[model samples]
Target: MDIRRLKEEIITYSQEIGIDKIGFTTADPFITLKGRLLRQRELNYQSGFEEPDIEKRTDPSLLFDEPASIISIALAYPSKMKTHVRGTKTDRRGIFSRSSWGDDYHIVLRNRLEKLEKFIVERYPDARCKSMVDTGELSDRAVAERAGIGWSGKNCSIITPEFGSYVYLGEMITNIPFEPDTPIEDQCGTCNKCLEACPTGALVQGGQINAKICISYLTQTKDFLPETYRSVIGNRLYGCDTCQMVCPYNKGMDFHFHPEFEPDPELAKPRLKPLLSISNKEFKNTFGKTAGAWRGKKPIQRNAILALGHFKDETAVGELEKVLKHDPRPVIRGTAAWALGKIGGKRVKEILSEALADERDPDVLEELEGALEKLNHETKA
Candidate 1:
């Protein structure tokens, strides 16, 4: 079998099947990434969501015997939604970052990889292939960087020349000696836009991100968000795109290559008030297909409440009062008190005092007291 022609065939088929970009690289250990990850762990900068096993992440040989090459594929997602949905002052909306705008890319990319795997298995009966998406042990960005899919950008995204940083990446490790594609030259020379634009300063420098503070990771966290980050989180319900939006390469880059990736404007930027009371069944049915829903509606609802406060939506006051007074989750109730404090009014002060007196949970009571004090101080001034 001619390996050169085989690679070309795979490329052609990938294009036909809706893969935006494909590249191959030798399956050598990612030595540099391991060192960086170790530094991240040492500094307590890691998000804790990543695969904890460092050895499994950097070495493909451990995942599969005699791995020859890694094939990386990228699918560009739309940056700008065609059908815009704006929110009214009374009904403010929160955004699910562009990455979560459509059906989960994990499923979409996995399907494409499975197709690629099938194609290879048919061609070479003995070929051994293992594919991974974002949840996998190996870093998708690292594989894509080595496979020439794109350069690992300053914001820690795989920035393809054709698609910028708004691309979903996946990879397949195989025991096929496919000639490796040349890695892209780092073109982000002297660009400080992403670093400057990061709300939490999560991008420590260049390609290194302290994920612990990244809005994307923070939004997914189940626990109460730190007070410092709450003010900076803005109206983002899931993920954060400030870094990519500020990228020069991402300018005018929007690809609607796959129908599954098309955004439902309502889901992408849903009304914040309606989300606050979204039932479990309703939330599942409406947002189940989107990537943002993976963390369930708790985080989204909490963010929505914060967004209401951020916008100072007086209309959300009653709903927030209900959440503060009666919600089953202590964290949600506590967050409601905080949001009410931000949307300060004499009514909000009264509401916080009432909730504080009635609250039994020590944590919720502490949040309520802080909110009441915040309001009381403002009232006196």
Candidate 2:
């Protein structure tokens, strides 16, 4: 079979399987991506995943002991849901920054890639294939860029004119040699909106990101969040989208209406009061299948208290005080203390004093001190 014909067949089958975009590239993206990963690792910027075992990633030979080509695919997310933008910190709107508002992309994209793999096998029984969504050693964004799907933008995300950056990427590494696509040119051209819009200054110059400072990374990480970033977290509970929201390419794109991705009406713009009151069972029931469900309920609950603190919503002080004394997670307890401090009053002060006496974590202790200071200063006035 002609390699070009096989490539064409792959694209056709991918589209037939409901993928939004397809492209192909040679299996060596390490030449461009290795240095970036190394820098991230050296700076301790990586959230948890180690620098992809470089040999496995770069060596097309390792991917498929006899690999000849890589087929990359992208699926554009529907762009229709306008994220809520009420200025009030009290508006505990459950917002999903486009990419996550639907069914988990990892599951959706992997399923499609598996189907594509089966199709290739039926056509060429001799060909062996491996499929990966975001879990593989391969540099997915680099592969997508080389495949002509898009270019890596200043925010370090792949950006295509057709889908902006609101697309999921998947790939099939096969032993079937095929003609490769030419990479697209970078179109970012002097624009720095994504950088400026970043809430935590994660996006540094020249397209580099310190993931440790990234709100997206912070939201997903299981470790305690530093106090400095607590207030800036604002109302974002699961992930941050400020950078993507400001990108010019994302403008005017149609919203994705995939039924699997739709937000549960109760979850979409939930009341802050209800979110504060939810039990662990309720949290699981509400977000179990959603992408935000990862890291379980602790992080989201912590973020909710932080958001309330930032909002300085007095009504939340009673609930925040309850968690301050009894929440199992130190991070949640600390954030609750901070929230109560910000919502300072006689009752919030009493809770802070009690929490301070029992708190063992130094970090939580510091937060308690900060809260006490705020309360004392208010009393003096």
Highest-TM-score candidate: 1
Q: Report the Cα RMSD per candidate.
A: 0.8, 2.3
lDDT of each: 0.93, 0.78
| lDDT value for model 2 | 0.78
lDDT tens digits by residue: candidate 1, 179-216: 99999999999999999999999999999889999999
Write down the RMSD of candidate 2 (Cα, Å). 2.3
**Candidate 2: worst-modelled 10 consecutive residues by lDDT:** 81-90
Worst 10 residues of 1 by lDDT: 371-380
Model 1 regions lying over 4 Å from their true place: none
lDDT of 2 by residue, 54-75 (tens): 7676666776777778888988
For candidate 1, report its TM-score. 0.99
Candidate with maximal lDDT: 1
Clashes of each: 0, 7
The alpha-carbon root-mean-square deviation between model 1 and the true structure, to one decimal in Å, is 0.8
